[model samples]
Target: MSEPVDPAPRGGGVALCLPLDDEQRLDASARRHGVRVVARCSGASELAARIPALRPDAVVAAAQPQYLDAALVAACDEHGAKLVVVAITRDEQRLAAELGVIDTLAEPFEWDAQLEPAPGGPAPAAAADEPVAATPARGEVIAVWGPAGAPGRTSIAVALAAELAGRGGVVGLADADTHAAAIAPSLGLLDEAPGFAAACRLAGHDALTRDEFERVAEWVPLSRGGMSVLTGIGSASRWPELTAERVTATITAARAWVSTLVLDTAASLEHDEEISSDLHAPRRNAAALAAVRAADRVILVGAADAIGLTRLVRARLELLEHVPPERVIVVVNKVRASAIGVNPEAQVRQSLARFAGIDDPVLIPWDPRGFDAALLAGRPLGEAVPRSAARAALGALVDERILESAATRPGRRGFFTRERRLA
Candidate 1:
């Protein structure tokens, strides 16, 4: 590999979130390095609010309030800015880099020499003979998505999450639907409680730790097992709170601690067309999009009826644009003999094979009575009616597919590398 020529002499902009002493040193260095200090924040809280408006090219801060949290890093990622954390000691420097900062520097260092790499450039390589940082184990993120028309997305997602919770290990269920969210009410959770929305805010400020996330995530009481849930907004108009960056941070942090994460997302994938010309305009489907993009597997749910099947096929086609086909699991919900004649499951499979080339799709039988009872009680289908046809079918899906996939998944390890304690 060869070094590329440096670009034009335009001064790069930076945002500072550092102590008084460190902040002053960074300022002096910025002047010496021909870089502009666009914004100065006393801490992470102020930094999170200012970074977006100033949109600096880089950010430098203390590692504690700096790189450890996903929110600040995600904000930097969205603004296309670089991050460099100041570490007072060698151990702190290693920890900072492990926490996913763009780069690390010891105090009393030369700023011009350290800022040599261009924005978006790869991190500086480790020494030839030195050991490299270990890659952390990443948990599985399963996103349940579908088009409009109540295709039973939430039911399948909740049922799947409940089942997985019983299998062992930690599981996180997130309601990421920006439009008309119902997870909280569906699960009998308190509508007034702060959940995913609050977690996103904390994540935005880089203040959400693993323990803090658990507090924001509501714990659901499953008859057979239990799982942690991050409920959706109380109202539809609050969609702006579930921005792509915040959603990504929440999910990323959840993955760090849990073995599996099930997400219930919105029906649409369309962005704001009226403001399409402006890249910063609010996207209504951002939560759904972020969930799908971050997922290891996407469970595509659709109704088994004619109109529902047509929408399912189209939705699958659209979903293919975002995730790989192999990673998608098709689930036909509310199957009934009257809708598609005798052997409804077989018919649905044939249709999918013909139109989308998807074989072995999971078909859930319609069970209005059981489903209605579960909905009224605000409990999972399995707990409300364990032997219900739909519930049994969903259980089979968990046994044959979801659980097996998560169990056999390779590289189950801690997300953060082992770091020496600070003296």
Candidate 2:
């Protein structure tokens, strides 16, 4: 196990923000360790406002049930504060990690025994000198695509956003599939305001701004408990103005306002030749490609069947030219154990490994019953069927892998980097 970090005197004092018992324990521990414990907040909101004023060297949040939310985590990021979360649940530890909580302590931890900084060291400087090089701020775009069949690209995109949002960060979900946009109906999103399409149009003319874009977003309520959604085009005819550059800028602006920006792209990456004949054909594939290039992580979804797998393999080869394999997360969807052949997971994995050389593809089992229920109830998998095996599998992927990856990747500038730059 890694050694416990010593309390660093990064100029600012330590602030203990936790519940009553944990706060008392931490206060005693800090006093014994020769580190000053400043203030303690009972609630996350209170702590959020107090953080900037107190400017604590480090904030120790006693990871109680109530304190585990995105708002608190986002507040920490906003203030560029170091956070240590003490978790009561293993699941909470996973969730905390997803939210970028640096140091986590399991429950029943002896505060006094572990609170001190190591003998040789103070903590690393609270803030870096060079403004810690931010990740490619909102410039990376990802367009999720699959063939016409039940390739489950939309499902993967929705789940991916839900996971990112659950990490206590802002996420934007854009439906860019003009031909057969299903994000709204799939998530039971009722607002048909064409906000994303409008944003795309405004961006085309360079009129998109952080404020304006937020005003345009429809704020589709989430079913799985956290984050909001932004729906897309009402019809394919509206695709004329949603060009690649405009879409890219719009998404960039959205990412500026949110931590994760998820685009539900068109199934076909090929240019619409019929529309190409027109002056305003709106090169769809180019727009999709631009989004793919901008995304920090790209999830490519494909059906488990033979034809769907074939299309995915082909798409994988094409995507490799643009994105690194590491950035591309492949999901084999609609796998059914009772289906025609061998176990769906093994078969799909074997096929991808054999042909596409893509190993360890994230397999989403076929859950038509659960999916239909969610669709009918207008909820995400977590809400409509929280206990469903499909939901459990999705949670494992989202809560475990995607969110964890987002947290550990240093240099990520947060969603509002562009706004910060402009300010």
Candidate 3:
């Protein structure tokens, strides 16, 4: 059991999790230093859970490993609370740094200037809470985007990455799906600690370097070329960590290291930030927009049926507003005769050309068995089912579209023609 000690003098907040006598001493020392004792607890576990809710400007926890854990630091950082470990020994000071703690306060409860919190201490914030500059778009970045429906956005992205990697060039696959990331499971990646989230965290602190970015990337070997993946957040709730600035920085760093970069972005592109009108408020779709704006090319994926075609048309229009039509490659997935009652591929191509002005769009055949086998095996389509129709179509897409785009890299012009632009 822990005790709550909210003493007098409502001023800058200071949370304390120390022994009983130590708590009294620290409380008195804080008051002497003119700092308000906002919260006090006996156990570190209690403080860890309470820090975000309590919203103290600074926390002073004993240097013991139990009191100073990574979870406490993460919680404090998430809520904008600065954690200062109370270290009385050299080992404790080193431990604090090893645990990724921001700062450390020496024992004996001294009147240190760092202990004093700034005016208007932090308030309790809910747990849920950039565009690339024109500087030499380092490497060719391909962003994959689609509308609300599943539309096989991630599947297409994974297959595209595998194909790009098969070209024998260094490829970086980034799963930037903030809403619902499936790249880890889709590729059978057992990533308990996703690299994308870690990179984002480092980027937020301006500590992410090219080396660190590469270090976080997990290698996924392809048949021909080698590919590395920066998996998305562990869960959708952790999207706040993937800020627009961080996403851009991470992508830039990834480009610095890889020959080709493939980004799998979120489904929506609504400018929620405009509605909020607050820069601090987290925009859920910022990651998607940032990836699209920063990319050298964008892959627009949509399902093949009537409803899917309608959504794709509307989604394509919306996408065109942010991305130039020339750079967007339309892909229709799951094309089957049963769904459209005709030559599915031709119908999809005809509908896209007639309705969305997307001619020669790549149509992927529905191969449930092949897709399921690869998914269950946690391997790529090329490795799991090379004979799959969808795999063959994806390989064609790479050979015809991506490779050609790469060849004419400098000052590259988009593929959308004048008629399609007008239509």
- Candidate 2 or 1, higher lDDT: 1
Query: What is the TM-score of candidate 2?
Result: 0.69
lDDT of 3 by residue, 1-423 (tens): 655556441323667876677788767776555556777776677777886567665566776776777777666666655455555453454455455431233334443534323335432322323111111234579999988888888888888887765543456788899988888998878668888888888887878876677678777755543467899887788887777888888777666555568899998899886788687888888899889998989998888888888999999899989988889998888889998877787788887788767777888998889888888987778778998989999988987887765322211122111111110
Worst 10 residues of 1 by lDDT: 414-423
Q: Which stretches of candidate 2 lie over 4 Å from their true place?
A: 1-38, 41-57, 60-142, 222-225, 272-281, 406-423
Tens digits of per-residue lDDT, candidate 1, 1-423, equal 111112321223666777667777766666555556666676665666555565555566676744235566666656555555555443343344345442233333345434433345333322223322222266679999998999999988988887765544356888888887788888889867658889889988888897687688887766533677888888888888888998899888777666678999999887565558878877888889889989999999999999999999999999999999888999999999999999998899999999978887999999999889888988888878888999889878877876554322211111111110000
Error of 3 at 233 (Å): 1.1
Give the clashing pairs for model 3: none
TM-score of each: 0.64, 0.69, 0.63
Could you give candidate 2's per-residue lDDT for residues 145-215 as a string of tens digits? 66667687787777666655544445567887767677888877754677777888888788887667667
User: Which sections of candidate 3 miss by over 4 Å?
Assistant: 1-137, 274-279, 405-423
lDDT of 1 at 87: 51
CA displacement after TM-score superposition, residue 6 of candidate 3 (Å): 88
